[model samples]
Target: FMTLLIGSILLPVLVLVGDIVFMFVVVSAALGAVVMTIYGGFETGIEFCHRITMAVPETYWEMIFPSSFEEKSTNWILN
Candidate 1:
């Protein structure tokens, strides 16, 4: 009879603790996935920008930003 009474009380507590642990693990996994996704996007953007800048010639930059060259803008598309 005493063991039955003890088990009844302890069983609920154990179940509640297990639920809390499960929730914590689920939330942690979700946050980790979000962070990894954002990191991946940033890495991709940086790589794309690096490629574009490296591939474009200096003349192209001067044409786009004439102020850097201390020259008047002749690009009609911008003007």
Candidate 2:
């Protein structure tokens, strides 16, 4: 029906807008945390950095660049 059509169209648009808003909120929170940690004048900055780095495992690079040698080859070709 007409309601179904409207729902299908509006649902995706709403979801996309929600995702954008959520991303902005997350970025703002991360920035605020970094600023507070840095200016708080304690070991908070170092601890935050350690926690952030520790959260990412060494295998992250493997997922990002699946083909190590091929990435360099493609970069050289493009440049």
Candidate 3:
């Protein structure tokens, strides 16, 4: 009974946290779109947004794109 009561009280808090995290992700994405548009032009920005919508799972991204530091290091060596 005590466990059930605690769970009930905690459930709403957990839901609120989830909502906040979702909102943050959305806002961050919007900001990224704006920045992409400003720096890369409207077409490039739209392409970026489209890519985000079509993106594969996170694990696949990790495999497909190296970290920026790693990429920079490789480019430096090549140059």
Candidate 4:
């Protein structure tokens, strides 16, 4: 019961944090569109878009793309 309760609370937080990075990606794309519309050039639009993506916090990035070891093992037989 305790494990279930803990998992329930932590899972959503994990999901939400992961989604923030995706949200930034979408935001970056939108920024690019707006920039292109305003500046009338692909290069300037992409330059600003890259800036936003590059600005994502390092910790947030780790959450967005975890290494293989970060994930739990899935080979049931081996486990």
Q: For candidate 2, lDDT tens digit of each residue in 1-79? A: 8889779988889999999996996686588568868797457666655555444335757546755564434332111
Name the regions of candidate 3 deviating beyond 4 angstroms. 56-79
Clashes of each: 0, 0, 0, 0
Question: Which runs of model 2 end up more than 4 angstroms from their true locations?
Answer: 42-79
What is the C-alpha lDDT profile of model 4 across 1-79, one tens digit per residue? 8888769997888899889988986886796669675887777677666555544435755546645562323231311
| Model number with the top TM-score | 3
The 10-residue segment with the lowest total lDDT in model 2: 70-79
After the best TM-score superposition of candidate 4, give how far the Cα of residue 72 lies from its true spot, in angstroms: 26
**What CA RMSD would you report for each candidate?**
22.0, 10.8, 7.9, 12.3
Kindly list the per-residue Cα lDDT of model 3 for residues 12-45, writing each as its tens digit. Answer: 7899999999799778878888999999999978
For candidate 2, the per-residue lDDT at 35 reads 86
Per TM-score, what order, best first? 3, 2, 1, 4
Candidates' C-alpha lDDT: 0.60, 0.63, 0.69, 0.64
TM-score of each: 0.45, 0.46, 0.61, 0.42
Q: Which candidate do you rate higher for lDDT, 1 or 3?
A: 3
| Cand. 2 Cα-lDDT | 0.63
Query: Model 3: which residue pairs collide?
Result: none
Which stretch of 10 consecutive residues in model 4 shows the poorest summed lDDT?
70-79
